[model samples]
Every structure is written in structure tokens, then in C-alpha cells.
Target: MKKILLTGATGYIGSHTALEFIEKGYEIVIVDNLYNSDISVLKNIEKITGVLPKFYEIDLKDKQNLEKVFKENKFDTVVHFAGLKAVGESCEKPFLYYKNNIIGSLNLFELMLKYSVKNIIFSSSATVYDSTAGKAPFFENNITGKTTNPYGTTKLVIENILRNLSNHKGLNVVNLRYFNPIGAHKSGFLGENPNNIPNNLLPYVMKVAIGELEVLKVFGGDYDTEDGTCKRDYIHVMDLADAHFKAFKFLQNSSKKIYEEINIGTGFATSVLEIIKMTNEVTGENLPYKITDRRAGDVDIVYCNADKAKKLFDWQAKLSVKEAVEDQYKFVINQNNKNK
Candidate 1:
């Protein structure tokens, strides 16, 4: 069986991708710091999959621990998903974001070179595109240098680093630029369990529906869109997880020509009001939300052109928005009951 080292294995995306990889019969050894996560998730993953990956609570920033993990595990591929992802928070503390996202990655890449693990799949973001340039359905080579936040800067920088690494005779990669990742596993056992306030729309709406938070604040309703709210390409987190598997397969015994950056998201775009309405429909709760001032760095519209991913990996997002919202609503109910 092929083995993979997964950094940030307890994260919103990494946790689900771990399930995807395990389901495909890959051996997984995970490293996570649990700085912004709960360890209870490993139990949930075990409950759902009946297989627990070897877990290491090691921060990627600690070069010593990363070196130890590399020395300890013999893996064929490394999926790097450990990074500070909150856009607003990245702005407030660019140093923290750079330290965790950039420097931590540099350390991991150096170790990958040391250990001779040349295959990697990076979790990139669509925020790297300029919201002002061409329309939605963003292609790979469009206005990437115009990101409005430090989070996007980190992703872009990592992509550049991975490119440089690919120059070596062994290292080859696919930088998967993710669109919006929302929803929970169908089992209601594992999902994007954000530790403090969530930075995305789906979780915020779910909180309002569950009464965790009283109101969903819709930021900036004056945009040029159908509903005057921000438009985004929201993909199901499961789809995102599955796409990683496809990309992994694409990387399996492939030509060097396959080393490229790809976008992974649904081509369809949804607005904030549509998402809120979906949440209400899924939860049977008419959530109370009001439009407020636009948060700085918030894009008016952004989506991805995932045609290349489909062509490259024969993978397309399969879950509908309704299905994702339903799963998320169910998971929130299960979570609330567990807390109670």
C-alpha cells in the first residue's frame, strides 16, 4: 500500500481528506499541533472509518519534530495542509501567518528533500486571484499577484516554493487551489469543526440556525450581484476531499508534464443570501440576519474554472448545495446534542 504523511491531518480539509485516502486503501501517518482543533475528531474519524491513522501532535514549525516525523515514517507522498487560514486574522497578524504558513512549509519541504519523498499535494486557495480581473470561473494564470490578504499571499508563496522544489529531479506536485469548502461528512461524525468563530459563511449560518450565535451578519450587501451580496464558488468539503484523491491518482506513476497548478471547485457560484436561505431550508429555521458594512479585503465575486481539474483527474464536484447544507445542519444538531 502507498503511504502518505499528512500535515494538519486534524484540520477541516485534512481530516476529511484523510478519510478519502484511507477509503482508497492508503496508509496514513498524520501530524497536527491541535492549536486550532479538538482531539475528539480522531475518535470521530475512527468511529466513521474503523481505522485510526498514526497520529503525531507535532507542530510543523518545530523543525526538530518535523525531522523526527520524517525519520520515523516511510511515506511515498506528503499532503501539506497545515497553515493559518483565517484571512482577517492573517491581516491582523501577518507575522503569525508567515511564520506558520510560509516558514513552517519551508522546513517541511527541506525535510521532504532529505527523506526523498518527492510527491506532494498542496492545499491552495482561490483567494490568490484578483477579484478585479476577468470574471468568475478563474483560470490558473490570472492576476495571481493581486491577492487582497496575507492568507492568499501565503498560499501563493507556497505554490512558488513548490514550483522551485519541482525543479529537482524527483519532486513533482499538484497545487490544488480550493474554492469554498463547506459541509460535514454524511456520517455526521467528522466535519469542519472550527474552534472559535468561523471565518466562512456556512458555519456562521449554521451557528445562527442552532442558536449558538443569535444572528448571521451578512457583510456588504451593496455588491454588484443578483442579491447584492458576495458571490463565491462553494464546493462541498467531501468533493474537495475526494478531489485530493483524484489528484493523488493523477500523480501516481504520471509524466512530469502533470506537474501543474489546478483549481478544485464547483463551477457554479452562489451568493450569501442563497447560502443563508439554503441553511434555513436545511435546518427548518428562518435565520435572522442583517446586512452590515463590507469587511475589508472581502471580494465582491470570486469562483474557479475547474475544467482543467476535470480534464486532468476526471473529477468534478458531485454534491449539490442543498445536500451539503443538509449534512452540515445534521452535524450541527449532532454536535449540539453531544455538548448537551
Candidate 2:
């Protein structure tokens, strides 16, 4: 079995991916700062997978501890999930995004070079896509330069760094550009755990259902979308997890010359209002919502062209939007009562 190192292993996506990797018979070790996540995720993962990752609780910016992890264990590949990920918060504190997302990642890359670990799969976001371009879906070959927000800029910058670094023939990198990741593990034991207020729509709707928040807030209902609101392709977190696992398979088999960037999404657009309506259907709750002014830097409509994943790795999303919401809602309610 290949030994895998996962950063931000206790995070929303990392937690789910950990379960998938463990099931695939990989020996996993994790490193997380716990800035916006809790250690209890390890327990949930152990319960679900019967194997807990070897964990180190330290900030990614801490070079001393990072070096120590590389020295102590042999990691064949790394799937970096460690970073600050709130869009609205990233705008307010752009430096934090750069430091944690970019500089911190540079530290990891340096360490990878030192340890001769050349393979990496990055957790990138679709926010790097050019939303202004006319399209039903964003293809892998689409000209994707104009990113809207600081969070997106950070993702784009890191991907570019991978491209340049790979040119040296020492590293092979895969940037898995993810769409809006929703849903929980089918067990409902692991799901999106936002640090504070949920920035993503699915988590926000779950928060409302769980009584942590009062109502859903639609940013705008006057856009040119089918529902007059922003539309996004929300891939299930589990499907996102599977895509990462499959991408790793491709990387493991490819020559060192391969450095690829692929999109992971359902290629199905769901509007803000449609998300709310679906939440009501799945959770059997009457949702309260009000249309407000559009949030700054939010794309009006964006779906992914997920064909690349199918052609490249035979991976595509299998769960529908409603199935994703159902599992996510289960986690929110279960977590809400525990907090109280």
C-alpha cells in the first residue's frame, strides 16, 4: 500500500477524502492546524472506516513541525487540503489567504522536495474559472485567467506555481479544480463543518434547518439564470472525495512528465432559490428566505464541464442534488444537538 499524507485532514473535504483513501487500502497520515476544525473528526472517521490516520495537530505555517513529519514518516504522495477557505473572509483578510494558502503550501512543496516526494494532488476550487465568459459549462481547455475574488486568486496562483515547479522534472502535480462541494458521507457522521457562519449555500441551508440560523438569504434573484439567481454546479462531497482518489490513481501511473489540471463537478447548475427549495423537500422544513443584494465577487452562473474527469480517469459525480442535501442535513442536525 502506498503511504499518503493528507494536510487539513480534519477539514470538511479532507475528512471525507480520508475515509475514501482508507477504504482504498492506503496507509494514511494526517496533519491539520485545527484553526477552523475540531479533532473529533478523527473519532468520526475511525468509527466509519475502522482506521484512524496518524495525525499531527499543528499549523501548516509551522515549518519546524512540518519538517519533523517528513523526517519521521515516508509519504509517497500528498493531497494538500490545508488552507483558509471562506470567500467573504478572504476578501477582508487577503494576507491570511496568501500566508495560509500560498506561503504555507510553498513550505509543503519545499519539504516534498527535501523528502523526494514528487507527486501531489491539490484541492483547487472552480472559483478560478472565468465566469464572465458565455457558457453552459466550463471546459478544462477554457481560458481560465480572470478569477473574481482573493480566495480564487490564491487558488489560481498556487496552480500556476505547480505548473512552473513541474517544469523542473522533479515534481508531478494534479490540480483538481472542485466546484461547490456539498453533502456528507453517507454515514452522515462527517460533513461540512464551517468555522463560523456557513459561506457555502448547502451548509447555510442546513444551519437554518438545524435552528442555528433563522433563514436563508438569497444574494440576488434578478440574475439572467433560470431562476434569476446565481447558479453553481454543487458536486457532492463524497463524489469530490472519489474524484480525488481516482486522480491519485492516474498520477501514480503516469510518468513524471505529466502535470495535469482537471475539473471535478456534476456539470449540473442549481440556483440559490433551487437549493433552498430542495432543502425544504429533503428535510421537511418550511424554509424562510429573503432576496437581498448580490454579494460582491460572486459569479452569476457557473457550471463545470466534467467530461475531462470521465475521459481522463473515468470519474464523474453519481449523486443527485437532493441526495447530497439529505446527507448534509442529517449531519447538521446531529452536530447541532451535540453543540447544545
Candidate 3:
């Protein structure tokens, strides 16, 4: 069994991936500062997987403590997921994003080199792609230097650093450039729990349905699309987690010391209005929403051509948009029941 080092292990995607790894019989060592997540998620993972992962409450920015974690455990692969992710927050505080995302990643990489752990699976975003460059359904070969926000810039920078390290430092790096990931696990015991206000649509919609938020603020309704709203490829969170497992297995046995990027998405575009409709269907509530002006850095239509992920990892999103929305609704219902 391979021992995996999962940074940001308590966060939304990280928590689900931990469950996936545990289910696959891999020993997981989790490290997180709980900056954008909760410690309660550890309990949730244990509840579902029946095994508690070895966790260290260490921040990646703290090189001394991070090194201590490396000295304690033997990790076959590192799934890098620790970073500040909100685009608006990144624009407001670019320095914070740079320090946490870039500097923290630098700390992790330096420690990895010292510990002789080379294989890594980086959690990346489709924001690295310049949607203005071409049509929708972006592929792996797409030119992606241009990004709209500092958050996206941080991901691009890390990808470049990993690319260089892989070539010169004998590192095996696979960057999974994911599209919009929504939904919760089937258990509803684990899901996205954003610290502050959610910038994503699905979470905001769920909050509105549960009466936590007043109204779902639809960003833009005048973009160049079928419904004049932004279109994105929303994949289930479990599917995204499954892709990480496949990537880890591929890296473990492969002979080539390669640096590669895979687009992880369903390759199907769903519009904002369509998402609203689907969420309403699942929640059984016609929640209130208002169409507003376009937010800065908002793209019209951005999905991915995930042919490479299918060919390379034999992975593709299996859940439909309706199913993803239903999972979110189920999670909200479960949370409300818990609070009561």
C-alpha cells in the first residue's frame, strides 16, 4: 500500500479525495492548517471510511513544521491542494495569494526534494486557460499562459515550476486542471463547506434554498451564450476525487518521469440558468434570484475537452448536472438535520 501525503486534506476536494484514497486501501497522511476548512471534516471522513487518516495540523508556509511532517512519514506521492482559491479575494489581496500559494508551494517542493519524494499530483484550475483565445471545450494542448485573476496566476506559476522541476529534478508531476467541481459525496456526510461567502454558484444557490442567504446573485445574464449567461462544465466532486486516485496509480507504476496536464471535466457545457433550474428541481424550492451586471474576469463560456483524461487515466465525469445538484441539496438537508 502506497502512503500518500495529501495537503489541504480537510478542504472540500481534499476531504473527498481522502475518503476515496482510504476506500482504495491507501494509507493517507494529511496536512492542513485548516485555513479554509474545518477539523470536523476529519470526523466526517472517519464516519464514512471507517479509518482515520494520520493528520498534522501544520501550515505549508512554516518550513520547519512542514519538514517535521516529512521526517515523520514516508510518502510515495504528494497531492498538492493547499492554496487560497477565491478569485475575488485574490484580486483584492494579491500579496496574500502569492505568499500562500506560491511561497507555500515552494516550501512543500523544497521539503519534497530533501525527503526524496518526487511524484506529485497538483490540483489546478481551468482558470489558467484564456477563454478569449478560442472557442469553448479547452484541451490539454491549449495555450494557457493568460489568466484573468491572481488566483489563476498562482496556479499557472505552480504548473510552470513543476514543469521545470520535472525536467531537471527527476520529478513526476501531473497537474489536473479541473473545471467547475460541484456536488457532495453520495453519503452526504462530506461536501463543500466554504469558510466565508461562497463565490461559486452551486453553494450560493444551496445557501439561498436553505434560507441562509437572502437571494442567489446571478453574476451576468448578458454574455454571449444560449441563455445569455456564463456556461461552465460542472463535474461531481466524487468524480474529481476518483481522477486523483487514477493519477496516483498511473504515476506509481509508470516508467517515464513525465510532467503532464489533464483536463478533468464532462466536456458538457451547462448554462447558469440551467444550473438554477436544476438546483430548484432537486431542492423542490423555487429560490429567489436576481440577474445582475457581469462581474469582472467572468468568462462567457468555459468548459474543457477532457479526451486526454479519458485516454490517459480512463476517467470521465459520470454524474449528470441534475445528479450533482441533487447531491448538493441532499448535503444541505443533512446539515440542517444535524443542526436541529
Pick the lDDT winner.
3
Of 1 and 3, the candidate ranking higher by lDDT:
3
**Residues 1-340, model 2: lDDT tens digits:** 7899999989999999999999988999999999888899999999998997899997878989999999999989999999989888888898989888998899999999999998999999887878777676888778777977789999999999989889974688889999889999887689988677677888877777777678788888888878899988998999999999999999988864668889998988998888888888987878898899987766677888888899988999999998999898888777877778
Candidate 1 colliding pairs: none
Tell me the lDDT of candidate 1: 0.88
Residue 40, model 3: lDDT of 90
- Per-prediction TM-score to the true structure, in the order listed: 0.97, 0.97, 0.98
Question: Which candidate comes out best when scored by TM-score?
Answer: 3
**Candidate 1 ranges beyond 4 A from true positions:** none
Query: Tens-digit lDDT track for model 1 on 120-178?
Result: 99999988888778777689888888888889999999988888878754588899999
* lDDT string, candidate 3, 186-304, tens digits: 88899988888787889988988999889988888899899999999999999999999999988987898878899999998999899999877777779899999888777888889
| Position 263, candidate 1: lDDT | 92
Name every residue pair that clashes in candidate 2.
Answer: none
lDDT of 2 at 195: 71
Q: What is the C-alpha lDDT of each candidate?
A: 0.88, 0.88, 0.91
- Model 2 TM-score, all chains together: 0.97
